[model samples]
Target: MKKTLLALLCAFITSAASAQSVSTVVHPEWSKNAAIYEANIRQYSPEGSFKKFEEYLPELKKMGVGVIWIMPINPIGKVNRKGTLGSYYAVADYTAVNPEFGTPEDFHHLVNAIHAQGMKVIIDWVANHTAWDHPWAKTHPEYYIHDAKGNFVPPVPDWADVIKLDYGNAQLRSEMINALKYWISNYDLDGFRCDVAAMVPTDFWNDARTQLDQIKPVFMLAEATERDLQEHAFDMTYGWQFKDVWGDIAKGKKNAADLVAYLHGEEAGYNPNSYRMLHTSNHDLNSWEGTEFDRLGDAVETFLVLSNTLKGMPLLYQGQEAGNTKALDFFERDPIIWKDHPYRALYTKLFHLKQTNHALWNGLAGGQPQLIKTADDDHIFAFSRSKDNDQIIGIFNLSDKARKFSSNDPILQGSFTDPLTGQSGQSASAPIELKAWEYRLLVK
Candidate 1:
């Protein structure tokens, strides 16, 4: 969580530019209620071509996904490459398309296909640094920060393969903002999934959000968790703290009591309008850590439902639906060996259910989750929500055995069928039954 030096410098620059930068004039509301899906292009298919990938838009739409966040499509920098393929974050050109992915026209076709499917696409944007081979490294030497020895360096200790951008120069900030606007203007992109967003100055994000809003409606997502970042900037930020809690519980270091505190603690930090993005796995977990099996294991399904049914937007990574069990190489051409499983069926029901139920909507539009008292508080976590007659109630057995629990909360109002089982859930007179690592979604 170390702050990248560039992030600090951009704060000073944003203050100076605020007087000249355009004020908040253009903004959209639809993004506030959208759910995001990360698309891993390199391993999406055996061929992994843009045209072939476009065909999945209909399938995604059927899953009720609203936003598609594509990983970096720009040309990768070759200098100091990591493996057969370098990190996508190492960008040689901000504007050019990587030939491996396909030509710009092919990407535009994919984008158009996404729009046609009624979903918006946001490309991953690496604003803190560029690949060492970037043209800016040679054209504008002053655009980069110098180390103690007067040499351009990577922003982080281990990121030696790239060069950090200098936000101290007002012109450099302009160049970065222009690059961001270019994507929105040319391809009609909804916004960006900023990489290592916490490493970039909050001010830079505030400014770029302002500029991009001028071009089109944008949804800004940061790969961070702090509330300060959401108070006035990003529409959504990563719920890494929540992720850590689930990881801890799975590892036997924590319990249901910890999860209650985490939910309440994060809610206090975030602003009324901003949201947190919850996910079970992404490119990071796929590459560095093991699969969900390696991380969450048996509780994977339990937590997956929690992520979708809880507050904020829920995300599903590319291979997660298929229950992929491989550790995808971050710096190589590793493709997922997909196999059919119950995960797809489980997630499909939850995804579609999320969109139709008003009590499960995003932001203030959705009802708050009030915890349901249970005799087994250590292992069973239960919560319910009610908006008028519509209600959403969930019960999860987080332990290795069954848990019988009951709640007096009226959010559990009315008798209805459980969405997961198509059977009766807990009624006011009757308690619910939960198997080990099982979760039930009740709607009335």
Candidate 2:
């Protein structure tokens, strides 16, 4: 009897182990090495229309952008609106496109055009809340949360334009899921970039993901950094902690050691298969906080390189390639002034490297970063990521002063080429010199 009980216990443990080994969230095959670009349609062009933005498809493709995450296309709520145009987060309708951007047909054409260019497109989904004027607010009031006086309230005190949703209502969940399916079934959308995903219930996301996958494999990106979101709901989550660390380093408040510590912490906290979206600037940062130039200053390019070569997926915001310096107005129409900038070339090179090099691919598809110890560990951040035959060693001077560092690691002594400069040379045991905020990438 004791022997039989031991055998049963062993069987149960083996089954549990096998279950834990398998990831619940399966990432789409196309997203394995893809870099995501945030397309802010409202500020992308002077016209701010889908047709106008479609003209840039070839250019974006040339830049090696794989996934284009377009901002919310739903109509804005006019009641209690913040400005003349109102916030994009305040969705007036889920199924209809905002007439200001273009007609629904125009959006359909844009999605088709993006796919034609061999790129995937994902639209922003605001599921946690809806505009105060949303039809459901009146017809199905139970879909929303109410105050003590039976009045609808915003998710937060500051966001008065939008009202919070009640996931406790099962009917609301079904309707919301149905609305999500409508886009996939009608427009053939690849996936969604869920807004404030953490605020909503996790089970809803899991159910939605399962249903969406039944139609087709979808890529889901959450706007939050919560690790649990990646377990079964999202393919990727925002790496806000890394962004904060990068900003602190630029402000002289942190150093290379701090950056290394953060990376180690991230590896320990999050699942290895989960993709984290790394970016120097996004729509929120560019419009609310500041542009990359404002926050990162001279270290802008350095951090950009780090974001791309790090162990996660990199995000390039619209206008970042053009080096737009102004803080775009959030509530009004502020067009990005396109110009010839070095940033475009730099991004092109880094993105191409990310595409061709398996070491820089997204999530588990890429290699884990191994620190290459250097003499100046405080200012010089050096690491190597290798997958099979492909390898990349990144050396960055994270401070303002010049740095001279030498690494005795055997991986550093090899014939490599710089993807950015197209220069080929052999790295010896000799000390390497780098200017303030300079970064070097060696590919083998």
Candidate 3:
């Protein structure tokens, strides 16, 4: 009996390993050193048409962006809508383009334009729920969850514009997966950024990912941070905790020591190959919470450096380059004001650095960061990453007062060039002086 049980366990382990191998092989090769940018279609411009957005592709490409994550392009439901322009998450038709955005052909052209500029396009997909007016709610009520009175209900009380999808029904799962395939077959989309991904069944995502790859090797990004999602479903998960840490530091609630502790915990907890999408601001944080300016305060630029140089893929939200100052309205037509800004140069330089610096690349493609001992460990954060001979040392003063930090760590004492300033020099062995919230990246 013991031998029989052991044999069964061995068989199960082998089967699981094979399944993981298949999923691991499906990651697109192009994503190895990629950085993602969130494109808010509704507020990309005053017009918000695909045709107009296509014109901005070249500039984005110039900024060294590799992936363009377009917000939900599906038509928004009108039933119990919230504002003059409803929320983009209330998806009415999975296969149809929002008339407010443009015709299907226009989106196709935009995708083509994005590809022409050597950037990949990923559409925001809300598979957990749909707008109240979605046909499935009326024609196939069994595909939705119902209240005690047998009346269809929203997933949560706050999200009144949409209704929850019932993945328990086999037919509903098949239909949702088919809708996913429709985008790949019709528009040749690269992949999806699943909204509220953790709320859906993991099995559904695993199945959907399997089918999606059959059409094309797609890159999937989950809005959630569950490590299990990386087993076979998503290439990247949101770095929410990291963002929270940044906010805490900005508010003087945490310091460099806290960040070092957090990094150690993350390294020990998550799978080494799992890619975390790091960012200072995203759509949800910008709309629901506040702009980076409001939350990050004086530490905004300092946090941006950490987001881009850290061991993960970084995200650039729409209007962030222009230093977007306001929280974009969630349910209304609010356009981003564009202008020449230093933030643009900062991001462009960092994006370029991310591409060339193997030590800063994503996932297993890059080297893991090793913390370097400094003069002030509590208020000064310092780390070094090296892949082969390529090396980068980053030091940031995470305090409200100017400070001098000295470190004898050989990994940091070397010849280096400033990617930001184009200055070249050797370390003077003197204490490094820095202003509050200042950072220095020394690359060799």
Candidate 3 lDDT (Cα, 0 to 1): 0.88
| Residue 329 Cα positional deviation in candidate 1, in Å, after optimal superposition | 0.8
Candidate 2: clashing pairs of residues: none
TM-score of model number 3: 0.93
Which candidate leads the pack in TM-score? 2
Total backbone clashes of candidate 2, pairs 3 or more residues apart or in separate chains: 0
Q: What is the TM-score of each candidate against the true structure?
A: 0.91, 0.94, 0.93
lDDT of 1 by residue, 5-89 (tens): 4464455445443422222323256654467789989988877778778988887887778899999999999998878789999
Model 3 over residues 268-313: C-alpha lDDT tens digits? 4556677889999999999989999999999999999999988889
312-366 per-residue lDDT for model 2 (tens digits): 9999999999999989998889999999999898888888888989999887888
Better of 2 and 3 by TM-score: 2
- What lDDT score is found at residue 216 in candidate 2? 94
Q: Which has the better lDDT: candidate 2, or candidate 3?
A: 2
In terms of lDDT, model 1 sits at 0.80
Candidate 3: where is the Cα deviation over 4 Å?
Answer: 1-26
**Ranking 1 against 2 by TM-score, winner:** 2
How many Å off is the CA of 270 in candidate 2? Answer: 0.9
Runs of candidate 2 exceeding 4 Å displacement:
1-22
